[model samples]
Target: MASFSEREQAFENKFKHDAELRFKIIMRRNKLVGLWAAGLLGHTGDKAEEYAKSAVESDFEKPGHDDVIAKLMADFQAAKQEMSEHRLLKQMEEMLDEAQRQITAE
Candidate 1:
């Protein structure tokens, strides 16, 4: 039997672990989406990877995912690519699932 303090500590550890995992999943999703967008914008190889990193960094600008979406929207518009916010959001959702699966598998 664990003491109360031990149980509390275990719970805290689990919470921290879950938070870290969630962050990783979100970042991975951002990278995946960035790659997808990069392809549409005519970036390839190292440029694509750099764009993906920028996508991950964009999330740090604000608390939620809006900053990322804004960046992507601006980029698409600048490149004269046709992309709707709805479609981009749907892509984010799909990428999120892929990110989770990838993280869990590793």
Candidate 2:
């Protein structure tokens, strides 16, 4: 029984609320993920925070907001990629060390 303007107002309120909630979720999830990733990568607290910020900034939204969300997701992926690279480098170092030890033993 709501008029068109009333329906529009209701949607605006819901949209605002949903956006705020989504941002909070993004920030919290990004912080947790970044913390774990940073620990594995040996990043300092400041660097970890920066990484988390980028991650939170980069996330997907609903179809109407895909442009903004897509950009943010790209940023999140980049941070994750950086962390992945760090882990890979550490693993490579361990492998190289083992190889060197085996060669010396022979």
Indicate which candidate wins on lDDT: 1
Worst 10 residues of 2 by lDDT: 60-69
lDDT of 1 by residue, 1-106 (tens): 4698899999999999999999999999999999999999999999999999999999999999999999999999999999999999999999999999999999
Q: Estimate each model's TM-score.
A: 0.97, 0.42
Computed on alpha carbons, the lDDT of every model, listed in order, comes to: 0.97, 0.53
Model 1 residue 92 CA deviation (Å) reads 0.3
Q: By summed lDDT, which 10 consecutive residues of candidate 1 come out lowest? A: 1-10
Off by over 4 Å in 1: none
Give Cα distance to truth, residue 100, candidate 1, Å: 0.2
Query: Residues 14-106, candidate 2, lDDT per residue (tens digit)?
Result: 999878765554445445554555555566779977765654454444443233334434544765644344453454345445544544464
Which RMSD does model 1 reach against the true structure?
1.2
